[model samples]
Target chain A: MSAVALESVTVHAGGKSIVDGVSLSVQPGEWLSILGPNGAGKTTLLRVLAGTIGFRGEAALRGRRIRRLHRRDVARLVALVPQTPVVPHAMTVAEYVLLGRTPHLSLLAQEGEDDRTIAAAALARLDLEELSGRELGSLSGGELRRAVIARGLAQAAPILLLDEPTAALDIGHQQQVLELVDRLRREEGLTVVAAMHDLTLAAQYGDRIVLVDDGRIVAEGPPAEVLTAERLASLYGAQVRVLFDGTTPVVVPVRT
Target chain B: MTAAREHGLPAVSAPHVGVPWTLVALAVLAGAVLVGLLVGPVPIGIGPIAGSALAHVPFLDAGTQLEAAQEAIVWELRFPRVVLGALVGGMLALSGASYQGVFRNPLADPYLLGVAAGAGFGATLVIAYGPTGVDGFVLPLASFAGGVAAVAAAYLVGRSVGGGRTTATLILAGVTVAAFLTAAQTFVQQQNTESLNEVYTWLLGGLATSGWGDVLTVLPYVAISAAVLLVHRRTLDVLAVGDEEALALGLDVTRVRLLLVGAATLGTAAAVAVSGLIGFVGIVVPHLVRLLVSSSYRVILPLTVVVGAAFLVLADVLARSILSPAELPIGVVTAFVGAPFFALVLRTTRSSA
Candidate 1:
């Protein structure tokens, strides 16, 4: 069964369709990258799959309907790293990451020894062990971005959803983060769905690309087929050149 | 692998404030309770109070050496007052912390959602319009109903106006309800000029008239509310991450929020009903614990209970002892300390931000 299946999903807000008639599926351990311009409903679609917002159509995980699942159960299956997470300035990095254990424990139960072990492993996985004792507000932008991903990693979910995970990070840190995520996916057999702004990075990592515009899927295929210069110009309304480095498509904007 | 292996798992469990701090807090509470029992206008020794308290315990042969009047002062008056102070203080602080966590606002207090104004209005209604010589519990019951009703109205209004999903709208709704209720209370006070003294006394807040009955009145509410808040301590920490992230982590954000607000409101109303509208305990005590101890709700909630209970009991001791025969209202004492401390917290938070 597919790891996630969204069939004709639609989200409406303020009398406008934010995500309309969107259907997509991801198999186990596959990385599906969503590429869209600003306000093209990429974030809204991710929110629907995360089960944080209401939707009209069916969104299922591992063949079970998401709407039928309890919030805690849905949380156990998927973990979301938001575009910009609220940082409690006083909370230590360890405490912030341990929040991922929420769905695993009973409502009234605190994090036990086992939960801490898992959280610690997640920290080590992200090379955040040294900074685990540091406050989140004290971290640099790249470090904070990694800490946020570390929190998502600690959730121990089978599927990971990242919304603009590379935003606000230096190119080197962005590469480090995407490489780490890819490593975790390969090793843990985790399914990955990411909404990415950088088309070249998306092409480098995504097993399949789904390009969306105005709440609808405009293109869906491998990076090479979907990222042609003509389509990019028409959709993005920019003069962009697509160069092929071996098989991966690299998008570069050209001045008029 | 080296980093993971070398770090081991123990580092993750390192607490910001550990067990020693808890012991110190408990010691402070015990000392405060002891001082409350021993110090008063009528200088009573700790021996007699301890002996009498132990003498009541089953199978204890401890004998009391106090005269009948002193025993009455110890058991009937001071003991109940101290217990009631602790309950009200602890409830207020716990509720305040819960409110802050739920709304993600550092300044949220137990009275933020109109409980004080509502209770004041309720008390004013009874004092001004009701027949004289009614049961003492009648006023408390009316105030309790009024406080709960005010919060309910605020919530309903918040929902209607701003969908209740946003905390700002709820807070604004609370301010609106508070203004209307305070106006109602003032109008009632104006009409019944003769009852102004009584209304004023109640509004200023005090535990001077507390008895065993008052202790019993607020106990169940305090216990249940404290339990609910304590259980949700970890959940409150989850909320620190904001609504969307918390939801992604599997928390039923709306349901948990409602449960917390309901529990805090219930306890705050009960505390206000018996003790009148005691201010600053909710806001100041939690902020103090956050400053001196740990900021995590897991630590803050429990430590604030002990610290707040002790703080209030000590404040009550000062309230009754400072003026001798003429008692200063307990609210006056808390506000005097609280207002400055509140300013300090505001400055520190601002600087940190």
Candidate 2:
């Protein structure tokens, strides 16, 4: 079953449709990258898939309509790592990870031993175990992004949705995060959907790519096909060279 | 064994930290209760008060001097006052904590939604007119009504003017309501010179007018409102994250906010009814509790309750004994203490703002 499927979805805000009639899918154990320029509705589409927004059409997660799925059930199947999640100054890294258990918890219940174990393991995987007791406000930009990812991992959901998780990270951390997601997908049969700015990174890691422009999907397919210089130029409105590194696409912008 | 998780560990540690706070509260409360029984206008030590109330008062030995003093001071003068102070103080702290969680602002005090000013106006009107004007219980009931009405009004105005957009409008509307109520109260107080003392006394707040009946009267209201707030604690935590996430988390954000704000307002108004407008407690206790405990409302709310009860008890004892024979207002003592502690909180924690 598809981990997520959107059908003719349109999102409106402030009397404007941020996403218009877009349909997409993420399959189990597959890594899909959503590439778009700013204000291109990548985030809106993710929100629709994450079941966090009201849209004109349907978003189904795990063969069930996202709106119909109970939030806990949806959360149990999919983990959404929001862009710019407010890292509360006083929350310890451990406690921040514990929030991922909210959906799993009984309405009146607290985190149990199993929840703690999952959180601890996720931290160790992200190399954040040493910083578990540290407050979130103290982390570097790269570390903060990793901390949030660790939290989503702690949720133990099979499908992971990230909104520009590497936007604020340095190039190495970006590579690390993308590599980690790829590894997670390969090992755990996780469905990973990421909204990313760097087409090169997306091309390297994504099994399939969806390109969005001006709140609409323009072209989507394998990177070698979608990242043609003309498609890159039109999608980005910048002249660029799309080179083949033995069948992989490498985007290089050309001025004049 | 008091965890919320199904099969969760009840005895999660840092008992070293948790135990000391409990010990401190117990010691302070014990000392306060002892002193509350012993010291007053009439001299009665613990031994004498205990001897009289337990052994002598009902046994036809009431004719004796020590027993009579015990009866007069311990039962009549001090006990009700101390208990009332604790009840009111706990209610304020409970409410203050609830508001802080709902508004996601540490600066949110019990009076943030204009409950205090509006309630003060209601009580002031009653005082200005005196017994001839209204029936007994009219003051408390009206003040309670006024407080709920004020918060509801603020929420309504806030909703219309961008409450959905941000929490800033609610804050602004609260300030607007507070200003209008204060202006009306000031106008009423100014017009009637004879009522000035009554108005000031109500505004300053105290436990001086308390009796066993007053303590008994407010307890159930406080408890009920507090319990309702406690049940919605998790929803309040989700709210701190933001409306969108909370909605996505399966909580109806609008209903949750109204329920919490109403419960908090009810608790605050009930406390103000008997205790007048005792200041600082609802704001300070939650802030202090958050500094020590995890940011989770589950820990924060309970700690606020225990700490608030202890604080008010200690403050009441000081107010009664500080200048002796003549009592100071409980509100003054709390402000005198709460302000500096708040500064310390600012120094230690980076301001979220």
Candidate 3:
């Protein structure tokens, strides 16, 4: 069975369809990357899979309808790393990471020893153990992103949704974050879906890429097939050169 | 565990940072209750007060060295007043902290969503048109109804204006509803000129007339509200991450918000109905607790309950004793402290941002 499936999913907001009819499926342990320009409904599609927004379409996780599932059940199956998460400034990193355990605990139940151990494991996996006692406000930009990823890891969900996960990171940190996610996906047999803006990184890491524009899929396939120079120029409305580096596609913007 | 340590990851324990804070808060509350019982116009000594309290315990024979009048002052008057102050203070602080969590606004207080105005309008209406010698039930009941109604109206108005999507719209609707209710209350006060003194006294807020009846009347509502707020302390912490993130983390954001708001409103209304319109205890006490303890709502909320209770009982003591005869309004004392602290919070948050 597919890990996540969407049949003609559509989301409307402010009198317009932010995510138009879209249909797709992700296999278990597959890495599916969504690339789009601004306002292309990429993030909205991820939100639909995360079950954080309402959509007018059939969306299912492991054969169960998403809308029919309780929020806690959905959370136990999927975890989302929001692009611009609100970080409570005074919240310590340990406390912030523990929020991921909310789905497992009863409403009034405090975090248990098992939950803390899991959170600590996630923090360690993300190389954030040293920053555990530091407040979120004190972290650098890259550290904050990693902390957010640690939170998602602590959820212990099989399917992960990342929205612009590398937006603010430097090149080294970007590679570190993406490599960490790739390792987790490989080692744990986790399904990975990411909405990314960097085409080169998408080409390098995405096993399959889906290019969207105006809330609809415009192209889909391997990076080499979908990210040609002509297609990138016409779809992105930018002049760019597509280079092949040992079967991997590299996108470089060209001056007008 | 060995593998994790190999990667230099420490096996962190549960972040139980609140044990000491809980003890401190409970100690403060105990001290405040003892002070409330001992210090009064009758000047009862601590030894005698403890002796008087111990004398009432079963299987204990502590000397009851106090006269009947002094005993009555401690038990009949000051005892009920302190208990009422505690209930009102705890409710306001808990509600205030919950409101701040739900709205993610630092300035949010128990009165943010029109409770004060609604209760004021209700009490003013009763005082203006009701019979001169109406029983105590009429006024408090009317005030309760008015407070609940005002919040209901605000909620309805907020929902009508797409408040379901964002808390900003709901807060705006609260401002509008509060303004309208305050105007109506002013009109009633102007019309009933003879009742102005009584209305003024109530508007200023006090626990001066508190008794066993007032204590009993507000106890159940306060208890229910406090229980709900305390249970949702962790949920409030989740809400701090914003609506979309909180929802993604498996919370029913809209439902959680509605339930918490309802709980806070119920407690605030009940407390207001009995204690008049005590201000700042809601804002001041919760913020102080937050400053002193961990910012996590798990810590801030429970600590706020005890600290708020202690703070208000002590403030009420000052209200009644500062002038030594003519009592100052409790609301005035809280505002004096709350307003400056509010400014300090604003400035610090601004600088940090």
DockQ of each: 0.61, 0.25, 0.61
- How many clashing pairs per prediction, in order? 0, 4, 0
Which should have the higher TM-score, number 1 or number 2? 1
lDDT of 3 by residue, B16-127 (tens): 4456777888999999998899877778899888889999998897779889988889888999999999989989999999988888877667566787789889888989
Off by over 4 Å in 3: B1-17, B130-141, B152-173, B351-353
lDDT of 1 by residue, A1-256 (tens): 9999999999999999989999999999999999988999999988998999999999999998999999999999999999988888888888888898889988888777777887888888888878998988899988888888888888899999999989998899899999999999999999999999999999999999999999999999999999999998988898999999999999999998
Error of 3 at A192 (Å): 0.5
Candidate 3's C-alpha lDDT?
Answer: 0.87
Q: Model 2 off-target regions past 4 Å?
A: B1-17, B50-66, B122-141, B152-172, B188-199, B231-240, B247-252, B292-294, B343-350
In order, candidate lDDTs are 0.87, 0.77, 0.87
The local distance difference test score of model 2 is: 0.77
lDDT digits (tens) for residues B254-351 of candidate 2: 67787788888777877887788887898788887787666767767876777788788888888878888787988889999988987776576545
TM-score of chain A of 2: 0.97
In CAPRI terms, where does candidate 2 land?
acceptable
